[model samples]
Target chain A: MSSKKLFLIGLLVSFLVAGFFSFYSSSQPDGLQKATAEQGLDLTVVDSANADSSLANYGVAGIENERLSGFLGGAIGVAVVGIAGTGIYFWVRTPKSGETK
Target chain B: MHMPDGLINAQVSIGAAVIAAGAITVGLKKSKGTLDSQTAPLAGLVAVFIFAFQMMNFPVAAGTSGHLMGGALASILVGPYVAILVMTVVVSLQALVFADGGLSALGLNLLNMGIVSIVVSTILFAGLMKLLPKTRISIIGVSATVAFISVLASAGAFVFEYSLGGNATYNIASVLISVMSVHVLIGIGEAIITGLTIGAILATRADLVYGARKFLPAHNLLIKESVVA
Candidate 1:
């Protein structure tokens, strides 16, 4: 498959999963969170530094509609991770013997 | 598991981060061999896919849900070095952007999620892949099993860190039991996703998958032979 097609498919999957499907995700505390609460370890958790970020908790900060917030948040995450990660990979990646980034 | 801040003392968090940094540094150097222009996009896609899967958590037990960790999955899709790098990116984004994980605890989270999980999965998967048949079915089976154990290893790693630097005063014995039990169930879920996703990708694009790359040329000829027969 062409790289363009591959990337598009990946982007579509990301959008579908994070944007459309994320609404169905479990809202209950995850394994570690539940264990900490039950194990009397909840007291130790410090608030996250980016807890106030617009896209915190996989939802947009000011978005009134939960689904929309989640949709936008998921899209943003995919974009950020896709760009930042691939960017870093290219930057730090070993250049071919006679190539440049 | 994404360990939040305040769970462990700052010293331990920083220590784990330091270790994680060293591992990532090595991954950067080693992955360079595997990641040229051709494979770079695939590596990034692996991160995106894993992150999306993580967003959709399924219920594991009462009041506790588990998501796909993708350590074993990534290692199988990409090589271990690039897989480690992919996982680090995912976890870092989660902490820095999603606020899902603690910023201060990013080191421990990276250690558990990226370093420990990938290392364990890579070692286990490589060893098992050697013993298993080169057939795609066998590969998926081994990948699933190893991915399951890798998740448990990550859980164990968390327990180890908790013992070392946990702010909680709970008994170490109970903490071990508590973490391992739920994580086992979570590992089952991880295994299924890892298996299914790899299976799907292999079915359509075996040539693109790194773990299956060595076997692809022969597999392609075998397919032609079977078709002729």
Candidate 2:
């Protein structure tokens, strides 16, 4: 396959893999959080300013579906990151006419 | 760390978001005046490699697994700006499509992992490289050691952020000590992987490797002399 095709495929595969892992992630806190809890630091954590934001808790209020909420959250994250990251990269790496190979 | 939404205070989240945005803007500008055909695709490939490696989580303890944070690796392999871009892509994908991190916590995640690790680590690596001999082995060693320090730096950044926005009433010292302790071990893993990967790339295709550039001319010249001999 062409390099372009390979790059595209790799990007898509990363999205799919990330989506799968996000969906199946453990509900328990991650290592650091778990350590914090054990060390008596969990209580010091505070709520974010946008505590009431729709995506704040990874759910749409009244959605009442954990699986659905997770799916939506995952999809939104992928889109935002992918779009933002690609946009930044393209903008940064755009070649001038005189610089093109 | 891929902070979930609701983990940090809103103010901290917003603040981190602003910082992340500013850094990304600066990175874009820096790349614009300098990025060439050679560097761009390498950046993208570095992103993919990071994503794949992140999937292979090592057991952290009895029941938990931790993965590589490619900030140091990316920065050492590519430049810091491109490394940040690579990490931003990875984190953003994890947050949005995989739900690995919280959507609302995107800024915090980017700041802790992407900006702190890549930018800080690159600075440390570059500074150390300046002092070390410009050999492939020295580059690998410095990259590995700095990768460890960068991970520790990120852990420190996380602790500071948590102190500011954490909901708990726990002692800051305790939090710092605990997080840093575990991260030290994690950093060793990061260093080994980073060292090996960079070494492999340098051995095969130094031209394609960003951080290995310092060794390229000398190594290439040595190769040519050997061929002539």
Candidate 3:
């Protein structure tokens, strides 16, 4: 398959996983949280500085609908990460043979 | 694991931030020499994929969940230098934009999740690649093994940090056991995902997989031998 086709497929899969399938993810605490809780250590005791951000906790702050909030937050994450990652890589990439930095 | 604030003291966190910054500087220098147009997009895609997968927490135990760390997978797809850059982007985004990990603990998170995992996996994968036969199965095998161990390595790094400056007075032994036990199961999940992803990519586009590229011709040669059988 062509590189472009593969890249598109990868993007589609990432968006689908983050935006749609994330809703079905387990709501239980992750390994670190569980381990800390088992030992009576509350890791979240001190709120993050960004805790008040609109996208805190993977959901939009003002959105009332759980599904919509999470979906939008995730979609935004995909776009931001995609753009940031691609731009950085492009900047860091070695120039082609005929090209000058 | 994405550590929240108050888990570690300010001194250790700041110290780790300095070390993480140093490693990233080295990674940038290394990646500039390694990455070209062909591999750069793959690295970027890896970051996006890791970010997306991290949001999907699968139930590992009754009350525990786990998600993909993707260090080993990224390092296998792109070289370790680019893998560090990819993970740095993902972890930084999660901390700053999503508020998933604590701001103060960002360096600790980057150290354990990005630096430790990638460094250990790169060394392990390189060693195994040298010892094992150059085949797709061997590449997948190495990926799974390194991915599994990398999770434990990350968890162990956290335990080390927690011992140094943990707020609570929990027994160090118990902390080690608790962290390692849960991560053992999480490691299995990580192994499965990493192995399957590398295997699929090798079958379709072996040229793009950094870990499998040197082995592909050998793999094809083995296939030819089997055809004669």
Candidate 4:
């Protein structure tokens, strides 16, 4: 298969997982948080400064529907990261030997 | 795991930020001549995939959840230097836009997940590739094993940081055991995902895989065999 096709497949899978399948993800705390809680260290844990942000906790602030909020938040992340990553890579890559910019 | 605010004291966090910044600078220099049109897209795709998958946390060991750090996966797909840049982009965006990780602890998060994981996994992957046969299955297996170790290494890095300047007082022994044990379970999940994803890409576009490059050309294999015989 072509690189384009492969890239598209990857993008599609990312969307399927982040936007749709993320709803089924475990709601429990992650490994670090769990371990910290088990050791009674949760009391000292400070909240993120951006905890009040609209996109905090992987959900949009205004969106009441959990599914829509998550999907929108994740989609926005994918778009931003994708564009930023692509732009950075393209700019950072050096030209081929003897090839002009 | 993404480190939130106040996980470690501000002193350790600032120190880690400096180290992380230095590594990223070196990575950018190393990756400049390595990436081209054919590989740049794959590198970007890796960042996007890691960002998306990180949002989908799978349950590990009862109530604890774990997600893909993508260190081993990215390192194997694109070389280590590029992988660092890729992970940095993903982690940075997660903290800045989604606010998933704490802003103050961004350096800590980047150090463990991006620098440490990729560096350790790359070293392991390179060693395993030399030891094992240059085959797709072997590549997949090595990826899985390295992925598992990468998670543990990330966890170890956290413990080290905490030891230096942890805010709360606790038994270091207990913290070590609990953190390492939970990460062991999460490592299994990471291995499976990393293995299967690499397998899929190897089956389709083996040429695009950086780790598999030395294994792809039949002439290279024949030459090595002839030398051995």
lDDT of each: 0.84, 0.70, 0.88, 0.88
Q: Write the per-residue lDDT of candidate 4 for residues B68-180, one digit (tens) a residue.
A: 99999999999888998998999988888877788889999999999999999989998988998888899999999999999999999999998898888888899999899
Expressed as tens digits, the lDDT of each residue in B3-64 for candidate 1 is: 87799998999999899999999988888745556556778888889999999999999889
Of candidates 2 and 1, the better by DockQ:
1
Clashing pairs in 1: none
Candidate 1 vs 3: which has more TM-score: 3
**lDDT score for residue B110 of model 3:** 95
Two-way lDDT contest, 1 vs 3, winner: 3
Q: List-wise, what DockQ does each model earn?
A: 0.59, 0.21, 0.68, 0.71
> TM-score (chain A) of candidate 3?
0.87
Top-DockQ structure, candidate number: 4
- lDDT tens readout by residue for model 2, A1-101: 34365446546655654445555544444467667667765454544445566764444445677767755654555455555555545655656674633
- Model 1 chain B: ten consecutive residues of lowest lDDT: B217-226
Q: Give the DockQ of candidate 4.
A: 0.71
Stretches of model 4 off by over 4 angstroms after superposition: A96-101, B219-229
TM-score of candidate 4 relative to the true fold: 0.94
lDDT per residue for candidate 3 within B109-150, as digits (tens), equals 999999999999999999999999877889999999999999
Which parts of model 2 have CA positions greater than 4 angstroms off?
A1-30, A40-89, A92-96, B219-229
Score candidate 1 by DockQ: 0.59
Write the number of the candidate with greater lDDT, choosing between 2 and 3.
Answer: 3
Q: Score candidate 2 by DockQ.
A: 0.21
Question: What is the lDDT for A95 in model 3?
Answer: 78
How high is the lDDT of residue B88 in model 1?
89
Worst 10 residues of 2 chain B by lDDT: B33-42
- In model 3, residue pairs whose N, Cα or C atoms come closer than 3 Å (at least 3 residues apart or on different chains), thus clashing, are none
Give the total clashing residue pairs for model 4: 0
